[model samples]
Target: MAHDPITAVVPAFNESETIASVVAYLIRAPEVNEVIVVDNNSVDNTASVASTAGARVVTETRQGMGHAFKAGVAAAQNDWVMKVDADLERFGPRLVSCLANARAPGIGLVKGAWQDPGDDMPMTRLLVQPAVAALCPALAELTAPNSGIYLMDRSRIAHTELRGNYAVDLDAMLRMAWAGHGVAEVDIGQIENDRRSPAHYSAMAHEIMGFFLDCARASSKASST
Candidate 1:
């Protein structure tokens, strides 16, 4: 079956140093019909560089990845949308193919797993991932619940609720599973980017933990119904 046109939504903040290369790589994908860069109030020239590199730039006033994504998804013109990080220097061409393969009939969401590039995976993230897996069968239904790279059918967006912070990916996955939508993962090869410093990783872990806590409470309430 012929696939629908794809729109890649790249959410960036202070990514001036690498935004162009990321945009360039996505444009090379034959399946990508358009690229939209959503800048989340970056202090640098992320928007200017992205524009110069031939991407349509949209600015999101809210300062989180989820906010940037909401703006980008609202602006997307394609039937399908792929969320990609702006820091990647060389997103493999096959990455697009992997995502497409997961879109087989009945699949509503496809997530991409990262092959860590020699960076130590944070103990906190490692702890949270499996904990989420064990506690939330709705989200654990997916092979990789926290993957940032996701290809979603536009129609599914209406049913998925996105939290306003870092846990949006996990939140979306749980909702997709609860809706009885098919969710799967595609093994995208190694992302050769620098890892976040320990401090940044700590901050991410805190944010993820908060999100999961909220999810657990919400899920518990729903189960009582």
Candidate 2:
């Protein structure tokens, strides 16, 4: 089946070492119409390298994934938007599957979980998943609650407030489910990336937990009203 052209939105920060390869891989996908790289004020040559690799570059002076993504999506010209991390280039077949899942009926959001060859931070399994299960049970079904890659129908995620950093993925899931849309998770294969520092990981955990707590409070307030 033929699917609508897709715009792949990549949020990059100091990824000059691998941004070019990542953009090249995304651009090669037959389903992708354009690869928009939102350079998040990288001190490195990330923007120039990505542009050299054939991606249309946009500047998001903001230094957060959520900010970069918001800029990228807004710049996207297609109806379908796929969020990809600039450092993970193992997209090959996974890109095709994401596009297919996005085209599936009644599915407003498609999230990619790392499978064989893909590795995730301990925080994902230990914190993000369990917190969602406790506060937002509906979203606990996601195998990879912290996955960075997702294909969303533009309208479905419009105006959604994303968390600033690593918490973006978990926050996105919670928001999507809160908005009453179906979210599907798929194994997109391996993603090669270095682990973050323990301090950074802990910070991400704090944000994930905060998102859950905030959502719980919002739900409670809505119910009481």
**Best prediction by lDDT:** 1
Q: Please, what are the lDDT tens digits per residue for candidate 2 over residues 1-225?
A: 237788899999999988898888888888888999999988989989999999999998867778888888788898678888788644456665554554576677788876544454667678778877887788777788777788877677643467676677666666777778888877666666666577977776777677777878988999999
Residues 1-225, model 1: lDDT tens digits? 137788899999999999998898788888888999999999999999999998999999988888888788889998688889888875566887788667877778889976766754554257656867766555554446677898887676562357766777766666666677778788887777676677976777788888877777887998899
lDDT for position 141 in model 2: 77
Q: Count the backbone clashes (under 3 Å) in each candidate.
A: 0, 0
RMSD of 2: 2.2
**CA deviation > 4 Å runs, candidate 1:** 123-125, 138-143
Task: Please give the CA lDDT of all the candidate structures.
Answer: 0.79, 0.77
RMSD after CA superposition, every candidate: 2.1, 2.2
Q: What lDDT score goes with residue 212 in model 1? A: 71
**Model 2 alpha-carbon miss at residue 169, Å:** 2.0
